[model samples]
Target: MLSRPSGGAVMKYGFPSLSNIRTRESYVSSYDPRTRTPAWVIERLGGDTLGGNADRKRCDFKEDDRSDACVRECAGVSVCVCVCARVRAACTQVSACVRPCSVHVFHRATNGDYRGSGLDRGHMAAAANHKWSQKAMDDTFYLTNVAPQNPHMNQNAWNNLEKLCRSLTKLYANVYVCTGPLYLPRQEADGKLYVHYQVLGTNHIAVPTHFFKVLVLERDGRQGGVELRSYVLPNEPVDEKIPLERFLVPIETIERASGLLFLPNIVRTSGGAVTAAANK
Candidate 1:
């Protein structure tokens, strides 16, 4: 049986039994604008409310809200990543400050044709957490929740992680990560924002993103990259700790544990850099 693997120690990921991974089945049948998402998915996804009812609290980032800080606090050190990256491991190259992040919105804003592909609203903070209410759940539908992630990566990564940890775990039992603000801000200088993740497994980092990033790159060195340290939330529950990179490891380790060969990204080799709007 496949078991949980953590830390820098690598596990051999042989091909998983085909039956193990369930095929994606639509949760709802007819589309109801009232319930943007199906009821089954909400229950399965661990949302507090079902039917998209505007019952519970939604993050009020709209006004003088501390939602941003709350999100950062909840994510805590990096959470164990179950998201599998076929093109090696990866993270949202999408920046936090980018404008009209929604590809649809951006297309409209630019007077350009809207492309079929879109951004993945990854909650740098997870959606299941208490921080997410019905409204929060619906709001997440906005492109803002999505960072420009390859559709395949977001689905596989979060889906697998959820299955492995039972319910999207938010702590580093085997692997630990710490993420926070950069001391000497360098937002504009590098063009790439810096967020540090400490993987207790490796006790070091080799990539710019979190646990998954360092593990996926299969390389070492922070030359063109930037780094930031995490702020410790005093007396926070262990379960709520953020999933930052506690330590860095090789992709082979992830491969062994996952039993997958995650192919490399085709565009990455062809010098295909993603063109994004400048940071606002």
Candidate 2:
């Protein structure tokens, strides 16, 4: 049932900026050596996907592979072609279809962004858990362009929520989140040094589900502030919920211990800063 709008093709999923947003034109347009670094959330790490200087790794499977997973009618007959789960092969579920993905297949996109090694199949507007909006057909939701984010958060926490939040979308459609000593492109050249996590797990998922989102402001050596702005969907956006320690505490604690809170959602107040930019 899910098909592209303009051309009536299968749809794709998306990822982040600073690790956040730009547009598809500026996104997939040819790559210039000057801007070898990716613009999307995956640029931080996953940037080295196919064209980057670094070697490819795991966690990418969920985003990179399974392009032809939709109904591909060939030879005058409608046929269902399920997408393969990984680059290698293992488990698969029709629900986990990649949409606003963060990597690329072809070496170059029509946008002119020369498909380079650092490129990723990014999704401008996430393809997963897309019931919230209907812009999938627009280039805004295209998988060729998106932002940079932690691979773990993109696939596991964020991705998990996409499926889990399906039924509960009625009660609390979206969740705003702010997790770390956030960092972004203007802030760092190579992108964040630490990995990001969506403030998920046990307690954080217990919110009443309204118009709530987490804001990640970076707090450097001198308590600077948060930076990134991202959101997560809960398994069940129960109308009756609270800030249970299950989700809140660990987030704060992780940041205090971390020295530099470049990777937002992962750190909390109790967590230490991994960077000594201020203390020194």
Candidate 3:
């Protein structure tokens, strides 16, 4: 039998950064307020967590309602109002109506930002991985868990990568997948490397230059061990015909590029035959 790890435990692994940590039903993530996207998201996938009566059609991409804008009123006077990026204009109107309107703003991307931005709201945590429960699937739709992605990339090659993660569940007893974005530097004409990317909407949601997925496959039964695989793809259209193995990269490469450490946690938690074909 598979030794079950907590579904979405905070202590399960070392996160890239400790800022703005949030846990959902199926995944644990760290939000980057500056970029308005998740720094990283980790989810556990097993046979039991694969299928259920969950309907994706019922789910919609939305702001993190758990921490939405709020206004505090004391003695029939509005004391403070914290507004989201999308409703800053409305907050201005409220401020005008109140004598001591103190407005503080929190940054979060909204659906309207992506409405005509020509970029898809790519999911850091794939929705299909949390089909075991509707709530789990719904959690994946939160805007905080998404980043700007090329439409073609999101629907084609990127989709294939997500499928590969699910397929691994059949081979291993469990699969722990960590997905996130990377801002790689490029050489400029002046012989210096620079990092640049587009920002969408009024919130200035950053579009990652590339994305990464690192998988930890747990071996089943008496012979307990784990295997590691990591892959990175650009945030643009890629030919679907290319084999995924071509995108396979060493775990350390992802660690350096995305500022995330995975091997240490794997060694600490699963003390056994840990091997990685990707590094070979």
| lDDT for each candidate structure | 0.24, 0.27, 0.74
Please state the error at residue 79 of candidate 2 in Å.
46
Q: Is candidate 1 or candidate 2 better by TM-score?
A: 2
Best-fitting candidate, scored by TM-score: 3
TM-score of each: 0.24, 0.25, 0.80
Cα lDDT, model 2, residue 186:
27
List, residue by residue over 42-123, the lDDT tens digit for candidate 2.
Answer: 2110111112222222112221222443323122332222322232134332232123232334321332342332322334
Model 1 error, position 143 (Å): 3.2
Once superposed on the true structure, which residue ranges of model 2 sit more than 4 Å away at CA?
1-119, 131-137, 143-145, 148-153, 164-170, 173-280
- How do the residues 31-137 of candidate 3 rate in per-residue lDDT, one tens digit apiece? 77788888888888887678777799999998864222233332344321222223433454442212111111367778887889999999988989878888888
lDDT order of candidates, top first: 3, 2, 1
**Candidate 1, residues 107-190: lDDT per residue as tens digits?**
111101113324233332234322324533444333222222334434554434433322322221121111111112125566
Candidate 3 has what TM-score? 0.80
Model 1 scores a TM of 0.24
lDDT minimum window of 10 residues, candidate 1: 22-31
Rank by TM-score, highest first.
3, 2, 1
